[model samples]
Target: MSQAALDSLIRMAPVARKSAAEMVVEKLLELIYSGSVKAGDTLPTEQELSAALQVSRPVIREALRGLQILGVVETRQGGRCSVTDLKPSRLAAPLQFLVGLDHDNVEALYEARLTVEGELLALGAARADEAALEHLEHMVHEGHRLTTDPLAFRVMDLEFHHTLMRLAGNPFLERTAQSLYHIGAEVRRVASETPGVLTNSAREHELILEALKLRDPERARRAMHTHLASILRTTREAMQQSP
Candidate 1:
């Protein structure tokens, strides 16, 4: 046999053990990461993959379901599964699962947001174009105007931060920030429900936007830190008060 064929055989060498479903999941992930499968590419039919991988149809279905839950693939009735754009919303289920089982995950999620938003704000200050700046300004004004309605204000608050990340001109950063936003949505809602949190959050947004408008990276960074710190404080207070 040729060297390439020998190598292929080596790669396919038997594992000591793995469940059928687990093997299917691993192979599918390998295909995805190796670029053998690209986003939006429809996967082979269940029957076909089962035959090719020597796994049962039920095992294949189970593996696909697992991937679907992770936002790695989308399945349609009577159609093949397709790779999906990995996104933050995809994290909702897993994040919620962990939050339910491990309370401390909530605090860790907020800390992640603080770190990411701070970097994004500094980048937005240094790189935002005129249009991006206008977008951020609009969100700021909208947030401020909605301060009396805590729920509405919270929505605008999230939008403003997301807009800042968009202004950062980095697709990876924007995606990561959006994912963090989705994961933290519930936490934010709870925080916003607390008395005075909305007002304080809106005020913080104003200062951050001012810094962005001035193109002052230091001020923007500092404002992001303060805003996120307040959010963390409010979140901790809310968690403590929960019955």
Candidate 2:
């Protein structure tokens, strides 16, 4: 980037509430979103950033490290950093940790799923072609066979949701939905251990598929809500039964 552009991007005023590193991270993100820093572009050197942001080197370092952990940036050999491609899968990596951090988070995660996947499934219903619908049908049939194997059923169950997300043709939402589906894998494994949990989930898959087959977006969304509600109930039961 030109010096003029860098100057514009890096000019920052001191903020009170948050830590300096946190403020730096927010400023850097603003630069990225504002199109001042394109993906794959190497960031300003540590010394340069420290000077430009009027922050200490350690603060800039901490901010960059945090961004690295979030998959927003990558460190090359010799300590140079550049923006990553920022794929949804990479950006959504931290969500796994966030989802299982506390007892209350599980419910909040499902609530998010209901909002995100509901719309994704509705889109899938409206947009899926014959091939997509056929593939989903095959998955539903396979799900029935996997009821005897909880682990395998869970895998298939996740894929069923993934396939639906793909049908929606939104990479961002697909990655988000997939990440959310994976949040409570251990609990879900236990939930699947319930005698009829997998069976019921398979049946719910059938209901979702039926709505998709009819190309009814509203019906598909409703089916997904019902399916997720059932899963959430079993998940809570499994959590209570855990110990």
Candidate 3:
């Protein structure tokens, strides 16, 4: 098929017929994927979009705001809206919020982290540069220095993994990593508070950084697996002890 025809089919694909807000979101996403609205391109004003789509201005604004929150759109002063290169990390806040409200289990978050971080670590080992490796080492060192403070160690741990993801040179992986990291933040906070958890995490960080610096893919993968296993074990034990 011609490229143009393929584009048309994608744009015209059936979307879930849901509430008006959802439909608006779908249509905007279609426009983005079809390149009718490229990144950085200005969207029609709320008034213009309402008129063109035959929807109310308030409806348009609401839909736009939702998209903006999703990192799909950027609204600036003077009411201008532009397309954005939204990343999965942008979903972290909403996902965290929803998961938090639902009393979701940490096991699900751990599963996701294991899968995404394992993949990211492999990619990072293959693609990381001197600068990225140096950053990773620095984060590990900082994490070690803060081993006495579980809270600070947890933050440093998150940064360490995030830096690894950034080194992978894949935006999708980076975003997935961010979401998993965000979801696990609370669990990590509690785990870090446990006696000896921070020290163990710091040691794991050192091992992972050493593997990365060695550029040994297999060792790096093993280090990542070992680190996650420790976390899972500690988290399960902690949950069991909780009243």
Candidate 4:
């Protein structure tokens, strides 16, 4: 971009005087939201940003770090910072920090799945293509075959949920649900370790598949609800038993 344009974009509003560093961050975010800067675009160098915003390099770097923490931009090797793809799931990067990643908060991950994924399943039941259904069927089969192996079973379980979300064709829902799935990994692993959990999960997958095959939205929703609820119960029991 031209220096003049960059300068105008980063110029602080002429109201109450906030710190230049904070204004730099606010204006930078404005550019992103305004689509003046887009995903996959490399931001101007720190020197350029510093010059444009009339802020010190230290202040510019600090602003950039805040954006990075939000998953808004990524710093590559050699100091190149680029805007990220802006996936909705990435927005939840602060959850672990804000909630504290322990047993209690980890449970939020499971609740998030149940809350978001039920809708995805209902939507997927109507929108899923033959290819998506076939892939989901394959995952169910894999889950059955891997029941004796907790790690393999868990992998299949996670992939199955991700695929289900993707099948919904709602980018925001898929992204948020995928993030929750990842965030709840520890709880999911614990649930998988519970006796008969994998077996029950595999069977539940079949029930979901059956509902999906019928193209019944309500049935699919019920099936997903049952499946997630089973795992939630198992995790709760495990937590109760823990020291």
The model with the greatest lDDT is 2
| Cα lDDT listed for each candidate | 0.73, 0.86, 0.73, 0.79
Best prediction by TM-score: 2
Summarize candidate 2's per-residue lDDT along 123-199 as a digit string, tens digits: 98889989988889999999999999988887788778878989989888887888788788888887888899889
As a whole number from 0 to 100, the lDDT of residue 31 in candidate 1 is: 65
| TM-score, every prediction | 0.78, 0.88, 0.79, 0.79
Which prediction has more favorable TM-score, 1 or 4?
Answer: 4
Q: Which 10 successive residues of model 3 have the least lDDT summed?
A: 1-10
What TM-score does candidate 1 reach? Answer: 0.78
Task: Estimate candidate 3's alpha-carbon lDDT, on a 0 to 1 scale.
Answer: 0.73
Candidate 1 C-alpha lDDT tens digits along 198-234: 7787788889989988999889989988987897787
Ranking by lDDT: 2, 4, 3, 1
Which residue window of length 10 is worst by lDDT in model 4?
92-101
Error of 1 at 68 (Å): 3.3
